[model samples]
Target: MTRLSAAFALALALALAACGGQPASEQGHADEHAAAGDHAEEAGGHSEEERHADGGGEHTDEQPSTTIPADVAERAGIEVQPVGPGTIADEHEVQGLLTPIEGRVAQVTARFPGPIHALRANVGDTVRAGQPLATIESNLSLSNYTVSSPIDGVVTARNASLGGLADEGAPLFEIADLSRLWVDLHIFGADAQHIRAGVPVTVTRMSDGKTVETVLERVLPGMATASQSTVARATIDNADGLWRPGSAVKARITVEQQPVELMVPLSALQTMNGEEVVFVRVGEAYQAQPVEVGQRDGQRVEILSGLNEGDQVVVEESYLIKADIEKEGASHEH
Candidate 1:
């Protein structure tokens, strides 16, 4: 063969080989891309499963809670108490007044008609029994005689004057022993039927909310003319002389006492998500727990469900925890 012919043939062979190799390289790159896509699909599916298993998926309705540091809780005045059994007093409330006991009042008067010579005791003077209150010259005896106090008490009234003609059996001084008093409570309607002698009663001072416990001494047979309500009486000691007559008071008559299984203070209850809940402490986190309630008294309520014994329940300032959780939810929404 000629030399130029041989060179042309070699160049043609080389060009054909190069074209074939280019197609193979393009196919290899395509296979690599397909393999990368399969690996990427597998990795994406695994990642999605991991998110669901780890509880980072599209689930809502998680239990609401808030994390508060111990110092912050103290500063917020949040208090916690364990729930346990207690008593619910089935009590009826009524209004009443403190009155001096009957038969303890004495009205002093002149034993005999005379002209008053000298008056010694005046209104508001404390006197002992048989103490001389006035001196007078009796018209019949034509001599000086002393008019004495008949009882030991504070002189509530004095109607006599010096040198005045003393009238017989006319009230000169009114004395009353106020060491003990009677609580006159007015009970009405069906409540009167539940109350009777020997039941327990709690008398509270309306002015200061001070309370004293006593038993019903008697229920007067007739109704009070002013209110037509049944009159119930209980004796109370006033040794300190703090209780005064004519002061309005509140009374609670315990008709029955019911024993309950679990109880919590009414202050422990809070409203969250339109339901009554109590903040329960777990570690540094407080969670709201819904509860079923039953019979209740003024200070406490019966917890029927959603609580176990020894649960540390927030008893004071629980609303602070509720507000914290609500604020957190609002921020998340924003």
Candidate 2:
């Protein structure tokens, strides 16, 4: 009985040892699989990091810059001008109309009331002083008398026709000498206060933008009833007869001429990222230089900061550069 009991205990002990050894072997294989998986994960992480480094190498500069070839800039009509000193004329813009000088106009009238015998002039006809314009049959003398132009001018109106009755003191022909003209600029509200005689005025014809520089002749005593504006007069030469009377024009009255240390054309200014910028060129790249500006006039502006003398600034077609830079930035964001 004792031997049987001892044999049972020994068999049980052997069975327990065998079960524990099998579990240890299975655990060793599982640990090896886990280590291999960790190594593979580490290698994959290194590959991902390498790919990121390669992508970074291809990255562009985040600064506000545009690359434009010289040929491209020329083709785009982009004009670059060096920053320098210039005169910024403090000009006040006002609307105006061209008129014939009052002293140069003539009203040809019949000396005595009668029937027109012969009409020799028509509208747009050029005539000289004392040139016969028409012949009138005087009622008092019952004789034909010749009427003559008193001044050299172009006929602007012909009130008397052939065989028409003419009245004494009534204008029969209106003539004007167009060699010189008066630009009647109307200055409203505050602009009239700065206006005075002898100030330089630049008159631009609204039709074709033809400009003529002249001096302010005078300011009328009375305000214009229709516009409630002061009338500033300037004389412009019209020997070519291109500036017609009664044509609307724009006048830039330069009240002050100030020489600035650095100035650029108004076209050189552009807006980038909600700030005023001027594109400065260096080689093939244009960088947006934020600038603080001073006084500005009709054609030019004073540069207070962010620019140096002789810096080549893009004065024309700068918007094109701005567009290209923004497009590149957008593509990078995506």
Candidate 3:
């Protein structure tokens, strides 16, 4: 009976041990599942944070849009104006130099062979007509010293010096009346037809920025052998002595005038595809319009076609607009 009791007790201990092991195994599995769920929640939260940081927009592989700087635009002093139908005058361009009017230059000479005693006038000296430029002691029968000047002008050349001998008709001095000057221009063969005597001309000195208004004095009878261009003379008044003889000058001669045509400032036109175009203001942007151009004045251009009167155009900073259009075009091409 005691042995039976011992076996029964051992069985009871075994049953309690089995029950404890099962509970411990079940708890470990539950803990592992809870950790896995927490990991999944953390991963989902990270993905959402990334999307918010990116502004909820897909990143594109494209160049960012650019614009002109405000400060640069302001500094450019851009201006705008309208195209108006008006008279247009064509001009011909020529290169020329300054010279005295006809018969105004004089060659001072001794009436008879003599020796120069003294020279009162030097090159570049202003002298009046009959002013004594030099004193000459005669070698002829007269044997007397004489003083003389033949014209009113600036002495441009002097051949007589003190104690120098002079021959009859020898040049003692060269005097030129600089009050009036001439520009001898070479007009191209094709352009020569429009040029005529008495045409109004505008002369400009590129060095000094001085401009003179004059008229075509004459056109030489022949063309230059080397350049095959005709010579056209333009005469200008130089009372202020600003137009120096032999100074280089540019001449613009008005050739023909059209009663009416569409006109715009020259600065408003830009070259595109070997054709002239103007940027017309449209809302906040500018659209380039191809134009047919005719004659151009100093700061204005004649628009023959492709534009109407009263079209608002950009007179300045038009190149900036052109650049923007080109850039956009290139981007599209890419």
Candidate 4:
């Protein structure tokens, strides 16, 4: 009986040992799983750090700078104008007409009541001073006298046809000298009061986009019935025949002018980050500098700050340089 009891106790001990071995093996596997999870978390943290670094590079990459070749600068008209004193004003644009200069229009009229016998000059015909334009038979003397142009110009108007009867003081032809012209602009209400003679005027031709410089010559009396505004006239030189009478134009008038110590071209100004900026030339590169602007004329702006008297500022095609710098930054980021 003793031997049997001892054998049973030994088998029971072996079974308990086998059960303890399974728990030890399970604990080892759990530890290995926990270690693997820790390693995966470390890898995820490294990836997040790399992503943050890449995001930070996006802003750091954008640097405002560009190099332009000499020929390219010339072609782009990227010339710099130094800050200097100039007349600055608040300008207003008005529609205008290019007309013959005052006292330059001529009318070929019959001296006495007569029957028109012949027509010599037509509209658009260039005629010299005293050149015959028409011939009419006088009613009193029954004799024909040639009506002539009074000035050298292209015929702009004709009131009679061939063999048409003409009364005394009747216009036969109208001639005007186009070499000198006047820009007639209209000003309304309070604008007429502000705009006076001697103010600068810039006339832009609507047909070919040509520009001419002139000044306000006169402010005529009352409002015209057709335009409902007072006429303001400025004399423009038309020696090149670029400006024609009766052609439409736009005129920029300086209503008020004041001298400024330091002024820059208006074209040099650009908006960046809600601030007015001007690109300053430094060797072969352009650096954008913020500026405080005051009075502004038609083409120039008063620079109150951020520029010196002799600092070179780009006056044209500055947008091209800004585009280049942005493009480079985008490419680098990609």
Q: Estimate, for each residue in 1-334, the C-alpha lDDT of model 4 and write its tens digit.
A: 3434533443343334334432465456548757875786687743433544655431121225554545445555568878788888788889988878768888888998888888888888888998888889999999989899888988999999887789999887889889888888988788888788998898999988889898898999878898799999999888777678889999899777789999988888888667887887766567677778997866888988877888888887766655555554565577
TM-score winner between 1 and 3, please give it: 1
Task: Give lDDT per model, in order.
Answer: 0.80, 0.82, 0.72, 0.76
By TM-score, rank the candidates, best first. 2, 1, 3, 4
| Worst ten in a row by lDDT for model 1 | 54-63
For model 2, the stretches where C-alpha displacement exceeds 4 angstroms are: 1-62
Over the stretch 136-219, how does candidate 3's per-residue lDDT look in tens digits? 777767566666777778888988888888898898888998988878888885788767898788899978878888888888
Of the candidates shown, which would achieve the greatest lDDT relative to the real structure? 2
Which 10-residue window of candidate 4 scores lowest in summed lDDT?
55-64
| Candidate 1, pairs of clashing residues | none
- Tens digit of per-residue lDDT, candidate 2, span 62-98: 2377555565466566789999999888889899899
Q: Which candidate comes out best when scored by TM-score?
A: 2
Candidates 2 and 3: which is better by lDDT? 2
Higher-TM-score candidate of 1 and 2: 2
Residue 206 lDDT in candidate 2: 95
Q: What TM-score would every model get versus the actual structure?
A: 0.78, 0.79, 0.67, 0.67
Better of 2 and 4 by lDDT: 2
Better of 1 and 3 by lDDT: 1
